[model samples]
Target: MRILIAPDKFKGTLTARQAGEAMAAGVREVFPDAAIEIVPVADGGEGTLEAALATGGEERTETVQGPLGEGVEARWVLTGKTAVIETAEASGLRYVRPRVQSALSAHSYGSGQLIKAALDAGAQEIICGVGGSAMTDAGSGALRALGLRVMNNDGARARLGGAALSTALRIDDSGLDPRLKDVQIRIAADVTNPLYGPDGAAQVFGAQKGADAAARSILDDGLRHWAELLHKTNGTDVQIPGAGAAGGFPASFLAFTTATLESGFDLVAELVQLEKALDGVDLLITGEGSMDEQSRFGKAPLAAADRANARRIGTVLAVGRSTLNLEDVTGHGVKALAAAVDCAPSVDEAIAEADRYLQQATVVALRNLDEG
Candidate 1:
């Protein structure tokens, strides 16, 4: 049997490549003679850069600002003139765990620095993955790094993070990098939240980033204020779907440049040539940390399953846990399922030993399919 294993990261536990390796081990246990190929994938989040580099690229690393003004080593992929930058590499939420008060001060300046580095490297196209952000500055910090100065009521540079945007007065882009006009910027994001409102950035993702009720209110207002400033500066007021992703990161690009928002899964899949990888595969195994109703839409696992199904291939989805039942999973063209939570003693144990539980679950899933 020819089996293809492709999975996304299991959050803080296992990366996509690690999950693929575990699934491969389980496949070997079941069918030692099976031809197994492991291809890790991502939906333009933390693992986007890795997925882009999987096929081969010039990996570049540089010291940039972290979520809280600290220096961090951020990595990106430069393939020819196209560059892949994952926001999580610089302003990732991982760096600000238990976010608390710092969430209000976190900035995306590092992401801008990454873009500048790409420009300096002669990139003609830049694909930025926006997710897992630690700030809700509506991409102000990033724009600032690109020479867009955000001024406060006092005509001075505004403080970093979401809160300070409430008092932000205006912006000046005269000093913005000239090369940005020549580059094609694609913002890769999955969420459909607008820039600021009830279902917007601050109200939805702010709490997770350590914003309380009052803080969320402040952040939401700040985004609104920032939106007005952007409109006054660039004559563009964008509030499109997916603009709220990564703390309204796309809003900045949409306002200042000709950047367009694209589906995260689609962008990365193209970069990794996922469709070609699935050709002639007998069984396609794909999954993420959690599989739920939301996963049925544009998530990478479902996208991968769709590709396999187009080729009349069966699919087995292995995940840390899933809210979808057999019927729901089957409706999505997935033939079988393997959940680490089912194999491990507890949810904590499942995450603590994700690799071990994932392998065991994959083995059981294949055995069950055989019995059926």
Candidate 2:
């Protein structure tokens, strides 16, 4: 039998690439001679570069700012002249884990550094993956890193992060990277949330990044003010879909440049040529760390399953855990779901040894498929 293996990162445990490798190893134990192809995928959050590299891209690294305003070396990928930048590398929540929780002061300035590095390297087009960010700066920090000066009425630069945008009086693009004038910047967004409001970035994603009720409210107000300032300077409409992504990271980019927002999954899928990869495959496996009702909202695994189902190909999800009922999962065109937690002694233990637990889970999944 021929099988296709594709999975996303397991959060704190396995990366999409690592998960695919583990799944393939388990599949080999059951079907020693089976034809298996592993393709790591992401929903434009983290692991975007790995997805790009899986389909043929080269990676490069440079030092940039971290979420907490610290310095960090981040990575980007290049496919011809098009550069792929994952925001999580420099501005993700992962860097401040265990102790740091609040994204109130997290900044996207480091992401700007990565973009500048890509531009300096002769990239003509930039595909920025704007998910998995820890900052709620509405992208002002990223703009500043790219040479735009964000200043208040006092003629001083504004502080970085979402809360700081409240004092943003004006943004000057005079010193902005000239290459961006001729470059095509695409915002690969995984979420459809708008910039600010009830369902906006600050209220929806802020809590996870360490924002309290009071902090979220502050962030929301700041985003409102920030949006108005941007509109005045460049006519940016903050109501656009995906504008609220990664704590409004795209808001500034959309307002300041001729950037366009597109589905993060579609961009990664096109790079990997996922549709073509599924041809005549007996079973296509795809999954993420967690599968739930939210997965229906433009998440990568659901998209992968639907594509395979259209071809009448069987699709299975080998995930860390699934919170959805059988009907909801089946409705998404997924034939089966296998969770690693089921085989693990405890959730913590499973996460700690994700590779071993996930391999055992995949074995069970493949065995059932064989019997069926």
Candidate 3:
């Protein structure tokens, strides 16, 4: 039987491609002659660029500022004149140390630098993958790097950071680089948060960026102010769903550029032709770091399962962790839910032993495939 192996990255452990390879190895151990296909997936979050670049793209590197006010190096993928920038490369939370969680001081200037570099490289279009960001500056820093003037009432230019958002009095779009007007920007975000509200950028994602209760409130208010200014200056609304992704970066892109917001998974899936690969496949195996209620809403595993189900193919999920009620996943077309920690010493230990455990788990899971 033909089986499709598709899974998202296991977070701190293996990448999606590695997880697929490991699972494929296990599947082969059980059914030596089984036809298996590996498809790595991402939800427009971390590893998005890697997944996209896998389908053939030119790689380029640039030195840009990290989350904190520090010099760092990052990379982007370019396909012809279309460049893909993963926000995590410049403003990811992973850059923050436990002792230095300064959400206020982080910036997206490096992301802007990457975009600028792409433009300088003669790119006519840019695809920004917005995920795993550490700043909530409403993309002000990015705009700043593009030569937009974010100034205070006294006309002094504001520094590149989110903490200055609350103090900004004016945004000068006339000073924006002329090159930006000719470039098309597309934001690939996995979330659907609006610019401001309970489900808005700061309220929903700020805490993860190391914002405390006070910082959360401050960031929320700052985003609100920025959004209002954006609306006033651009004469267009900035609070559309998904506009709050990547710490309100999408809102800024919407306000400043002719950027279209799209689902990262859907875009990548179409690029990879996952649906075509799923056709005629006897069984589809998909997974992620964890499976839960959130998985139903455009996540990578769910996206794969949805396509497989459309073809009436059986789908099984093998996850590093499982939090969804069995009924929840079963009803969503997952024939079986397998976890790597079936008999591990502890959850932590299980995660540490994920690769080995997944191998053993897959053997048993596939052995029962024919029975079902």
Candidate 4:
């Protein structure tokens, strides 16, 4: 039998690659002779670097400004002429313990620094993974790091971070790095929120980033004003989908450079060449740390299952846990779900030994598939 084992990270435990290995090991116990292939996946967050590296990518690390302006080390993956950058590695919430005020002060300059490093390394294309950002500065800081300048009324350059956005009056992209003119930027974001207004970065995602009602209000106004400047200085439009992601990072990426926003999952799928991997494969197995309605919205497992279904291949999932029962997802792309918790003593136990439990659960799910 030919099998494809693909899975996302198990969060605190296994990485996407490790999860695939454990699931394959379990399958080997049941079908040692089974020809298996493993492809790890991510949706543009923490696991992205692993997924990229699994596909013959190289790693490069650099030290840059953290969200709160302290120095932090971050890394990116390079595959050929393409570089993959995980935004969270540089400007994520974990770098600065988030408070309602964290949103205002956190800057995404580190992400920009990474971009500069990638460009310096002769990367002609960049895939920026936009997730878990700590800033709400509309990615101005990132642009600044790339040679764009923002000046306030005093003709003095504005500071970086969300709080400083309120003072931005004009922008000067005349100093934008010339390499940026030739480089292609693909933003890996999965959401569709715009730059400002009710469903925008500040109003929808600010409170969670440490913004209260008043702070959210301030951030929203900041974003609006920033958008106007972006339009004036660069003729960039912010009404597009994904403009609000990473605290409006895409908004600036759009205004300041030539970029296209694509689903992180689709981008990952393309990177791994999933279509070719699925050729002649009999069955597919996939899962993540969690599974439910949210997975249907562009998560890797369901995305892979959808591809499997298209090819008439049976697919099974073994997730860390699930709030919805298997029946809830019946006929919804997955053939079945084997939750690790169901095979373990407790949820904590499942997460602690996620590799073992997920492997065990995959064993059961495969047995059931074989029986039926």
Model 4 clash pairs are 100-210
- Using TM-score as the yardstick, the better of models 1 and 2 is 1
Q: Residues 48-125, candidate 3, lDDT per residue (tens digit)?
A: 776767667788999988877688778898887788888889878888852224787788888999999999899998
Q: Looking at model 1, which ten-residue stretch has the lowest summed lDDT?
A: 97-106
For candidate 4, lDDT tens digit of each residue in 62-88? Answer: 999999999998989999999999888
RMSD values, in order shown? 1.5, 2.0, 1.9, 1.3
**Model 2 residue 292 distance off true place after TM-score fit, in angstroms:** 1.6
TM-score of 3: 0.94
**Which prediction has more favorable lDDT, 1 or 2?**
1
Using lDDT as the measure, the top candidate is: 1
Which numbered prediction scores highest in TM-score against the true structure? 4
Evaluate model 1: give its lDDT. 0.88
Question: How accurate locally, in lDDT, is each candidate?
Answer: 0.88, 0.85, 0.81, 0.87
Instruction: Report the alpha-carbon TM-score of model 4 versus the true structure.
Output: 0.97
